[model samples]
Target: MQVLLRGDWRQRLRLISGLILFAFATTHFLNHALALFDLQAMYEVQQWRWIVTRSWPGTIILAAALVTHIVLALDKLSDRATLRLPAWEFIQLALGLAIPFLLLPHIVNTRFARDIFGVNDTYLYELARLWPDSAVLQSTLLLLVWIHGCMGIHFWLRLYAPYRKFQPLLLLIAIAIPIAALGGFMVGGRAVAQMIADPKTFDEVKQLSHWPSPDNADRLAAMRLIVRLVFAAMLTAALGLLVWPAIQRRYWPHFIINYVGAGSANCTFGPTLLEISRMNGIPHASVCGGRARCSTCRVRVEEGIDAVPPATFPEAVTLASIGAPQNVRLACQVRPRGPMTVTRLLRPSTASPADVDEAERGSEGIEKPLAAFVLDLRDFTRLSQKKMPHDIVFMLNEVFAAAGSAIAVHDGWIDKFIGDGLLAVFGEKHGIEIGCRQALRAARDIDLALDHINAKMEAEFGRPLRVGIGIEAGPLLMGRIGYGPNVDMTVIGSAVNVASRLEAVAKEKGAQVVISHEVARLAGWTPAPELLSKVDIRGVSEPLEIVAIPRGRDLPASLLASIEDVDERVVGRAAF
Candidate 1:
């Protein structure tokens, strides 16, 4: 049973019901808005209700929807403790529960008794029972129902960007509609009472009880039973929708992979994975639905790479942003198109797969020296703001793609992308000398890649693209952090910060690439005479020597010669 709930179709059904309930509330509000007009307008609402109620299908639908919504809500409530809910959310839940209970008596008194049993009571008869004496309870129930519904709509609309802009207006409308309708109902009640006191005006209230009288007791009982059964089914479905996924977690515990095509994979049945993990007492992160929207469920396909399907649309979008390799896929999206083997790259939620994979491969040795490189796009903020959203996305995609490919080709691992910049780490398991050499070579490769990207963009957009890069060498701590399902692999220390600062200096000096004196020393290379300079970096008290490569130029022996003279003077100054 739990397994059935975890299935995608069941979840989809629940989503559809939720949408239906939202629609019902919207239309109900619109009907109540009629109160802003006159008593005749309120009468017209009753006529509309009569039309809907008389229709067999409409009656069945409404009954079922109400029952389903209540059941699902109650099921969710049972899953979590009341004490765990925030005070406001708990209050809302209480109000929602009260709505059906309070509404049941009123519905029976007005619609059911009159329409089904030939009670022949006017609208005024029901209004008089609740006015003034029962006013507080009536008003409270109305307010609770309205507020609960409006809040649900608010939450739903928040999920989409287009609706966000009109949120304030939507809220105002939600509040105002209920207030006006309740006020009008109260005023109409008073008007009806006044008319009843006078025999001459009694005839005016006669038409208010216009519902056709039922023919027999048997027919009436059948109608009532049908209504109850319909509502019961709807309520059961809603409750099942909310509760089944949890039940699945308790029972089903195996990971099932479905294959789609060649070189592509998706992580379907992740809820089952989560459930199995929990049953075996293994930790997993799925704060949201196990959807590919969040990259928390990332994994690396270790074997059968050729049998996996290409990335689906959502998976591709997220992977492209993070610069994930072809072999890496989010566990939520990698549905196996054919037979495949995969390892959970992200052992924990917070950790990136690349770092975890590296650690598992025994690439993190104590003696291994790493070189860090940072590449920042110059004038990205101003440029991005001036371009259209799609254009900005396209440009960033091209830049990151080229930069990431170049780093990977040179045997480097990208640590992170910092806004409009890229941070690549080299030699997590290699010697200091080799790390520095690879870092320098990667820098040159990135510069060349950018040139290719710029040429392509120049032809398309009639403008050149620009970026600045910096490289530095130093010892660092590298490992994984976090417990169980939420772990992350990253490097930390002063060396990382210095490398980032060097990138900043490169941007300020109008250079495409900058190398710190330490990196140059490790490389055993002299900078060109005109390519070396000293610049004061923020957070550093003294100026440091830097070798700059101008934009649209290739690194050469002359540039290395200038770096040597600049390095000598800076080292002497530091010694003094």
Candidate 2:
């Protein structure tokens, strides 16, 4: 119970209550849709619906959910450090806030009058009062409520991959339900209007409706006004809560923040660096908002690191996972305590929610063992000098496309394309052992793809294209780097550097692929002694042991076959 009062519990409560309210609204819309068959069909469905909805249990649950949802929304609004939000979020918020205001009169007339004034408030009574007169207002309310519910559902469900698969069908259903209900409502209203035009039918419906006397109707009107006034006061109080802090904090102690390269801004102590950036129009990358999930908003504290408090629990976990230096901090988590000088690690650009992947969420800010695959096209400068610029671009595109396809097939992420070279990372999801084998397989696939491409391109170009492939595995920090459209999720470590060096070595030795001894050991492969060699690598103190494959296709099949054998052995032991 105490846990429910703190941290993310409020968000959970809001979602659950909103879902209950949405369910109620859906059933109501479905009941309205039955009016297409005729007023009798609508009447029959409403009777059954009222049996459940008008019961004490249903009424209490619905009333509780509605009150809770609204209160939570207002509380969230009051906690906002800045009104700066993504466009979709802003639209959803606006629509949500508008719903209660538009819905109040209808609720007061129907439910309040039915309960307190002994009015029947049946379909006939509602249609006679609403048709053609309140039609537009009612339709507006229906659309707003439906749209707001769908947006909330979409934002929440999109976090799960399964929901994304059925989003198109779900969206179609969302659209069709409201439209059909609206059509039925209009059709039913017209039918009621025709009936009311006849004096005989009008007399029957009026008696059956059990409408209140004129004096009672006047009393109901005054009650509705009172209810509206009370609601207005509550709304005003919520807005005051939102605004009072901003006004009071204007006089709070301010701190100056100096961002290297970018300009500086002065702000009060409460808002985070990322919020301060947005408030001041400074470009900052925060792909996951300020949730401390994505580390895109990390900055190196160049000065005043000592004055700033250490990272909180969540921030510490994210920073440690990403192998962030002691001086580095997430801009979203760090509140400026005093004057500080910091450098933004990621450039600012427009980043959408799509930029974050749910499956890869856990790996975002982490150090893990990953295999690096670096491939460089050989003699590309000479080829470019011989060919026209367009021809060069076309040729490079084909090569890159083939290489990218091959890497993807083996579960590798193409980190970046460097002129004529490329870098890929493996083992983010799987362990390093499987990742090493996958890298070797990807290197072989790339070789085969290039062979096929050369067969067709040899007629246009003078000769076949050649590439040097290198594979290495070690603990590496993987993260999203750069800013704007140029951003890439890449790996950075000495292992990547060594992989590039091995690619150069492959070119120097005139071999197709060069892999470190570590790769062979991890992948469960034992190369012939004669095939192994020790070579000095640049920026390294000791000579490295490696294997140079003359042809990628020549890699022993046993390297992959061993994995099945190991799995079988484990299963066998478990069975005993």
Candidate 3:
């Protein structure tokens, strides 16, 4: 345990160093935001900021954090065998690598120059030097650093209970602060440009910067040389990590990763699959950037699960919460110690095989035909207007209880409740035929359940409760929608919409249960020829044909055999 913690010290140090730097950067950006108010206010605030930051203890802490962060980052780059990263992580990495190059010049001219030459720095002096090209560089630098910091913080707190609730507010601040800073700088620069245009103000600014000194010119030249040398040295060190490992590959061992479902074999010398996937252009999802915060990138090891180390605390907690089997592991957190075959499990509940393949690039949902069942309690509105709120709520609870149970029994899900109505979907797992059949059975069962409920509640209500059930089975979209707080897993498309319209049609025509012709045909329930009727529906171009079934009991076995006979004749397959 001690050895494990010791080896993890580098990662811990990097996080702490990053947070300290982020704190400093945040304060600096906030100071820049003040420029939107008044340039003098910006300058005035800067004094107190500098007073705190430039103090002996502050200087030591800042310098130490900077060196530790840079050194540890370089070590990670060297240690890593693959360069695969999620889009945001890649962006953050690129920006982090660019920071020193953008920052060195500014740092040397101000922090170093102030210490060495006793230069009096002010807003006017900064404005003259930084306006135009330098302004763009500074703004880019600020944003890069800020974004990197924000990503780090997000990765750290993403799994925490409280952070998830307040994330929107954090996101708002993260976005608004940088924009305000950039705007503030532009406004301040405009004022400074006006100052420089006046000959008197220009001279004073130049004097403050100690310009025209052969000594100052030499110092500026020396600063540029130092920045170049530092950047080159860092680059060389990073490249060496990659080069040295490759040169020794023949002498060292390797690991083979067999993707059980992706239909491809891949090899990597590295430990982490998350990095290997990113580096190799394999489509994978890692919401927490490999920190094991969220389990969206989890995989089930088919073989050699024991070859990797046991789950760490974070991984264990996350896996247990989801009731993942012993074989399941987070791809980001697990780095195989030996060859392993694994399958990714972070897919939508209803995702098809094809959808899973495409979703590696992110969530591209599956489009399929499904049975959409829309059930609306007839005259619910009239009943609601007359009943007390509590009484109506009790009535609604009973309705949901009956409808929801029937949906579950038929292998369907209650999509949502609409006042006294409920929307359910079948074919989530089974194909369209069985889905439609299940819908028909569920509708019948719901009617029977409602009859039972009304029997017990006849004294409470003067009339029996009635419901209209509409069903349509056809091609539609099924997948998880949204990200962050807005995310949902459900089906969406024309079939769902048409099913909803059909429910209204049922209410309009005074039918207890109505199935679109498509569904009736699909479910193999060809009601007597005369039972089929026509009704106009919105979004559908022509008058829609439907079947009005009369029973509130099990669909006859003859219906299943008839449907199979039709399919065997047409598609040559008995589906149900």
Identify the candidate with maximal lDDT. 2
Tell me the spans in candidate 2 whose CA falls farther than 4 Å from its real position: 1-12, 33-52, 122-132, 157-180, 183-199, 211-253, 269-272, 287-337, 342-367, 386-398, 433-466, 474-498, 505-576
How many clashes in each structure?
A: 46, 0, 3
Top candidate (TM-score): 2
lDDT for each residue of candidate 2 in 75-114, tens digit (9 for 90 to 100): 8777777878767778988898888887777888888888
Candidate no. 2 TM-score? 0.75
* CA lDDT scores, all candidates in order: 0.61, 0.81, 0.74
Worst 10 residues of 1 by lDDT: 258-267
- Residue-level lDDT for 264 in candidate 3: 42
TM-score of each: 0.43, 0.75, 0.59
On lDDT, who's better, 1 or 2? 2
Candidate 1 total steric clashes: 46
| Local accuracy of candidate 1 as per-residue lDDT tens digits, 1-576 | 211122234334544565665566556555545645766776667667657754788677766776666766665554431123333455766777667655655556555777666555444555555667777777776787778776555433343445667878887887787777677667766776776768655554444544333454355456556655655575566556546755664464433342222122233332333333333333334322343434455656666677566776666765554556788676555544445555553554433323323433322223245788888877787777667889988999898998888778656788878888888887664556556666776677667787788877776655677888888777767755443333456666656788889888877778887888878777767777788888877666788788887752466543333334545755787899
lDDT of 3 by residue, 437-538 (tens): 888888888888987899986568778888888899887776546432233456788888888888887777777777888887777666777668998889
